[model samples]
Structure formats: structure tokens, C-alpha cells
Target: MNWYLKVLKQYADFKGRARRKEYWMFTLFNIIFSGIAISLDNATGLAQMGVGPIYGLYALALLIPELAVAVRRLHDVGKKGIMLLVVLIPVIGSLWLLFLLVKDSDPNENAYGANPKLIPV
Candidate 1:
């Protein structure tokens, strides 16, 4: 939860490196929150999603953080952050970026910052 909020706090900040725990924890929280919002509507038997607007805002709020983290993560690999653009290449591009995203961050540091994975969560 702290990781998720920390990412939000650093929203659009592309300069620093983010560790895998921060990135994946934020992703996990985002998915979980969105699921909870949807589940509320389902449980209530309401025709409309009761928390639709809230969840929508949650998504809007996190977009910049997501982009910044991805770019910085690429930087951690000594790769140009713009390489993230390769993710746009349909099936091939998306898979390629997914590979980069899943790979471990460099053991120590690169040009970005300290290894995010090494930080004590």
C-alpha cells in the first residue's frame, strides 16, 4: 500500500529508478482496488457501478506514475527510456516490452537511482 501511494506521490517523475516491488505492488494494489470497486456494484445488485466514478479517477490518477516508472525502469537497464515506445508494436511490441518489464532490474544501479528491488519494503 505504501508503495502504491509512493508511486502516486511521484507521479510523472521519470528521473528516478523504481524497484520491481514498487512497480508490481502498485500494479497489484491498482488491480485490487478496481476489483473491489466492481465487486461492490456486483454485490449490491445495482444496475450501475456504484463506485464507477471513483475507480475511474483511480485510473486517471495513476497513469503518469505508470508511464514514469516504465521509462525509469528502462533507464535502469542502461537502455534509452524511449525504447518503451517499442511496446506499441502490436503483439510483438507489447511482448517485447513485457520482457523488459519482467526482467530483473540491474543488480545495483545504473544512471537512474538505486535498485528498487533492493530497497526494504
Candidate 2:
């Protein structure tokens, strides 16, 4: 939960490196919350009325933070943020991006900043 909140605090920040733990934790919380939102929408009959309003609003609110954390995660792996566009290629591209995100951080800092793992909490 701390990791998720940390990412939210960073909000739209697209620079710097994010630890793998931070990225994955945020992703986990997002999935859980999305599920909850969808359930709420369904229970309220919002889904039958139209699009799932709650889910749509939740997704919209997190879009920027999601991109920011992903960019930072790529930075941790020593890739440029633009590498995120690789997801556009096709199935292979998304797999490649997933591989990149799952990769461990560079032992030493590159151009992004000092590794999050090395910094004292």
C-alpha cells in the first residue's frame, strides 16, 4: 500500500527511476481497485445503464500515474521512457515491454538517477 501511495504522490512525475517493487505493488493495487470499482458499478446498475461509470472514472484518474510509473520503471531498467511505445508493435512488443519491466534494475545508476534500491529509506 505504501508503494501504491508513493507512486500516487509522485503523480505525473515522469522522470527518475522506480524500484521494481514500487511498480509491481502499484500495479497490484490498481488491479484490485479496478475490480472493486467494476463490482460497485455493477451493483449500482451503472453498467447496464451505460459504460461502468465507476470503473471508467477510476481508470481515467489513474492514467497519468500509470504512465508515470511505467516510464520510471523503464528508466530503472536503463531504457528511455519512449521505449514505452514498444507496446504498440503487437503481441511481441507487449511481451518485450513486460520483459523489460520485470528485469532487475541496473546495479549502478545510469542517466536517470541513483538506484532506488541503493537509497536508504
Candidate 3:
């Protein structure tokens, strides 16, 4: 939860490195919340209205932060944040991005900034 909030606090920030915990925690919470919102919409017949519920709006609200975190996470791996565009390539693109996101951060940092995992709390 802290990780999720941390990402939200840094929303729109794409210039720094982000630890895996930061990225994945935010993703996890996003998924959980979206699922809940969708379920609520379906249960309440909002789905019949074609707009579903608030999930679409919530997802829209988070899209920027989600992209920012993903870019930062890629930076933490020593890759350029622009590499996020790889998600447009289909299966291979998504798998490659997932692979990149799961890798441990570069210990000494390359160019983005100091390792978030190594910074003294």
C-alpha cells in the first residue's frame, strides 16, 4: 500500500528510477480496484448501460501514473524510459516489457538516479 501511494505521490514524474516494489505494488492495487469497480458495475446493472461503471474513469485517471511508473521501472533496469513503446508490438512486446520489469534494478544505477532499493530509509 505504501508503494502504491508512493507512486501516486510521484504521479507524472518520469525522470527517476523506480524500484520493482514501487511498480508492481501499484499495478497490483490497480488491478484489485479495477476488478472491484467492474464487479460493482455488473452487479448494479451499470454494465447494461454500456458505460459499465467508474472503472473506466478510474483507469483513465491512473493511466499517466501507470505509464510513468513503468517508464521509471525500465529506467531502474538501465533502459531508456522510451522503451515503454515496446508495448505496442503485440505479444513479444508485452513479454519483453514484462521481462524488463521483473529484472532486478541495476545496483549502481546507470543514468536515471541512485537505486531506490539501496537508498537508506
Clashing pairs in 3: none
Rank candidates by TM-score, best first.
2, 3, 1
Clashing pairs in 1: 19-116
The C-alpha TM-scores of every prediction are 0.77, 0.96, 0.92
Which digits, one per residue and each the tens of the lDDT, describe model 2 over residues 16-107?
Answer: 99999999999999999999998999888889554498999999999999999999999999999999999999999999999999999999
Winning candidate number (TM-score): 2
The CA-based lDDT of model 1 is what? 0.76
lDDT score, residue 96, model 3? 97
User: Which digits, one per residue and each the tens of the lDDT, describe model 3 over residues 1-121?
Assistant: 8888988999899998998888898999999998888888888888755447477788899999999999999999999988988989989999999999999999995889999888854
Question: Which lDDT values do the candidates have, in the order given?
Answer: 0.76, 0.95, 0.88
State which candidate has the highest lDDT.
Answer: 2
Per-residue error (Å), model 1, residue 99: 0.7
Relative to the true structure, candidate 2 reaches a TM of 0.96
The C-alpha stretches of model 3 lying farther than 4 A from their native spots are 48-51
